[model samples]
Target: MNNSKVFGSTLIIAGTTIGAGMLALPLASAGIGFTTSLIIMITLWALMAYTALLMIEVHQHADNSATLHTLAKQFLGKKGKWLASFAMMFLFYALCAAYIAGGGAQFAERIANFTGVEISGTNATLLFTLLVAGIVIIGTATVDKVNRVLFTIKVLMMAVVLTFLAPNVTESYLMSMPIEQGLVIAAIPVIFTSFGFHGSIPAIVNYLDGHTPSLRKAIVIGSAIPLIIYVFWQLVTLGVVNQATLIENQGLSALISTLATTVHQSNLGQTIGIFADLALLTSFLGVSLGLFEFLGDTMKQRGVSSSRLAVGLVTFLPPMGFALFYPQGFITALGYAAIALVVLAIFLPIMMVRKARAQSQLSHYQVAGGNLALAVTSGVGVLIVGAQLLITAGFLPALG
Candidate 1:
């Protein structure tokens, strides 16, 4: 395999994994304590990596051009296709809504800082939605280039924030109050959302032309980059800002504002805001592109036109409507997206892989640990689903 292919694919996976979800980490994990949150982050990273490999395993058995929807239909019948389609649509839509809500708020803040004029959240969200949707309508090749540029800027900005905040981290803040068991359980969905990269698995497989070793290497390395970043981020944020402050205020905006005050650096707020806006924009572009392509393909499969206008309308309208109605729901939207992710990325992959094995299908790349691995993956899925259910049923409090 060529070195460029491996490196490019790795970037794709990394770009897809690190996005709006990272912005919520400090706030979402704050209640759980930094140390415990780190452990959860590591566990979810490993679990997500396993599921991503399983996705690749299933993809290998299908045609190279096949998507998750197509694979589900082939292996799991119409019911499976419906499940995959709904999960993908729901997950991507939630993410798009979150990006709009978060990104628009940041844009408004930045503008207000400069002009001394406040932009309403609804107006900001509409503007950002139109801008991002326009970019998505241009198609993937253009979005791919823009994603690379944005991803590079995002990493650099993250490093800058980490560097500035490193000295301000207090030991007292790092080891803040212990969390209730229920709160920790409630954080599972947010943590799972942070490690999401399964959307890029099929893209990587096609990018590498099904080169298993290269694809495996790309997935492992790409996923690990975000894991390391999350650990350092949690340490910095939790070590600088108090738990009570995070829980009381909630969301990335509050975190950034608090960090600025805590560090006594007013400019830090603007820096972090810019960093966050870029993060959301990059993630939104990647996810929106994936959704657009998927919808376009499905439309074509059904003998629809799948024109740029039609694809763009289907892709951006629902998310825009959701964002318009619920402008301050970045973290809440992420939790919902995580639930859909569990269904499509976790449960569906396990079911498909088992069916593949039962049919005596073989792949050059199989997730090791056999039935035990499958069982463990299923258990992880159940844990996530149960956590969400408990939150919905009022047995556990929801994360902000």
Candidate 2:
């Protein structure tokens, strides 16, 4: 890939992966020992890569230009389309809402700590939403340009924190025993939320030369980048922080602040707070752009030429409302929403491939040697995560 192409690909990967989940990784991994978390990270990474490749299969095999909605419509008809749309709409927008609320809350909290300005989540959300909404309404090219900057900043800020925190990690933290299934059940949604590979498939496919081989390579390479970043970030974070402190903060920013206090007192603590705020804001900005683009593209495909306004509202209103009414629900709601997205992103793509195969449309590389094995592995992973999600949602009891 050309430097520009690689940069664009990496930006998509980074943008997809770095969202509300990045903020909560430590907390999610806390119950599962650091070592187990690392293990899960590897498992999820492979699973994500497999699914991304499968999505490429779907993209290639389709006879017409399509998005996930149309793919579901082709494979499973009206009902499947409805389910996919519901899940995508709920999951993507809810995440954007969570980002706005969480980012706003974090921003307000940090500013209050440093300055005496009594900022509320509602006010913060309003300001942030307006800024993002303006950029989104302008168009896709502008959004991509802005994302390049935000993504670079986010990665850099994370790098700084990792540098300071990695040395402090103890082997004992990484080697602790895994928690019971109850915690794992509760954590699946959180884990899924942090992994955002599914949403990028359509864009990657479009960017590719529209050939099976190139699309496959783009999706595989693209998804792999984030998986590595997630695993690396988890290692650096869990390594440096004390287990109990990690549990206590329940948010990455707070844990980093605590880390700073121990490392260099209140001075360093404030600095970490600012960096965390910037990183999260960048994440929020990227997601807002994506959400706008998704909605606009969906509407355009439906022949709605005036989707730009709808996209603006879709990006802005929900999060602003959540920030106003119930800022705290953002993260927990995001966890559940993530399960739905994973179903769409990971599981549905597999289903698309199977449907293609049944129709005899699946190409050779799609069902290539080892890919079926990867698919089976992905299926097993989904069952584990799905059962855990259902149990956590009270649809099933904890496993005996």
Candidate 3:
């Protein structure tokens, strides 16, 4: 394998994994405390890594050009294709809505802070949506180049946050237990969503020219980058901001505003806002590109015109409408996304691997652990879905 491709693919996986999700992480895991959250993070990282290899395992037996749609159709038939379609649509739209809600508010906040001229939340959302839509319509390479710059800025901002908070950040908060145990269960879905670079597996495999060992190395190291960064994030944010503050302010906007003043560095909050904007923008570019392509494919299948501009319009409509009415759409949409991801990311990969293995006539690359591994991973996915359902229905305690 060319070493350069491996490095590029590694960045792709890492960039895709680290996104606006970090803005939501502290709030989600705040009540559960850092230690438990760390355990959960590591365990889920392994599970996500395992499923990604399972994805590659399926690819080895299938066509190199196959997408999730083709893979599902080939392995699990038409019904499975339909199911994957619905789940992908749901998960992508939810994420688009989320970035709009969170990223737009931050944009508006930044504008008002600097210029003293307030932008309406809806207008801000519209502007950001159009920005992403335009870039995605241009092409993938544009998005890739743009994301690299934003990711670089995001890293710098994160470094600044750590520096500002370092003097006061304590490890004690990492040791703090949940005020109520149920928060641990409640935190699972959000945390699960954080490790979501699985969607990039097929693309990365293709990018690295189907070299399995290189692909495996890319997956492990790429996923691990976000894990280490998240650990630092949890340490700084949780160390200073107690559980009560996270509970009191459910709105991301409100919570971030509090952080600005809480940390006593006058510019720290603004720095964090810039960090979040880049995160949201990078994530939006990725998710929008995926949805745009998926929707374009659907339109072509149904004999509709799949022009770039026309498809882009249809892509943003649903999620934009949701953001208009649901100002709190960021957290709400992410919660809904967690459930859809359980189907799209976890269960589908497991089912495809099972079917592919059973039908293979010759030896090929396998991900190890056989049937037992799939069963265990699927079980965890099920638990995450159940936990999310409980949180949605108000049966479980939710910190934010």
Please name the candidate that would achieve the greatest TM-score relative to the true structure.
3
Please identify model 1 stretches exceeding 4 Å from their true place. 305-307, 361-365
Residue range 63-157, candidate 3, lDDT tens digits: 66678878999999999999989999999999999888888788788789899998898898888788888899998899889987987888898
- RMSD of each predicted structure: 1.9, 3.8, 1.7
Better of 1 and 2 by TM-score: 1
How high is the CA lDDT of each candidate model? Answer: 0.85, 0.68, 0.85
Q: Report the C-alpha lDDT of model 2 over 218-237, residue by residue, as the tens digit.
A: 55666667677777777766
Against the hidden reference, what TM-scores do the models get? 0.94, 0.84, 0.95
Per-model clash counts, in order, read 0, 1, 0
Q: lDDT score of model 1?
A: 0.85
Decide which is better by lDDT, 2 or 3.
3
Q: Looking at model 3, which ten-residue stretch has the lowest summed lDDT?
A: 165-174
* lDDT (Cα, tens digit) per residue for candidate 1, span 1-400: 9999999998778767877898898877878888888888999999998888888888778877777877899889999999989999889888988888778778788779899999898887888888888888987788878877887887888888999999988888777655688988889998899998887677678878988888889989999998988888888889988888888878667777888888877578778888888989988987888788878887998998657888998988888888778777788788888889999889999999888878864535678989999998899898988888888799988776
**Candidate 2 TM-score over all chains jointly:** 0.84
lDDT of 2: 0.68
> Which lDDT value does model 2 have at 383?
68
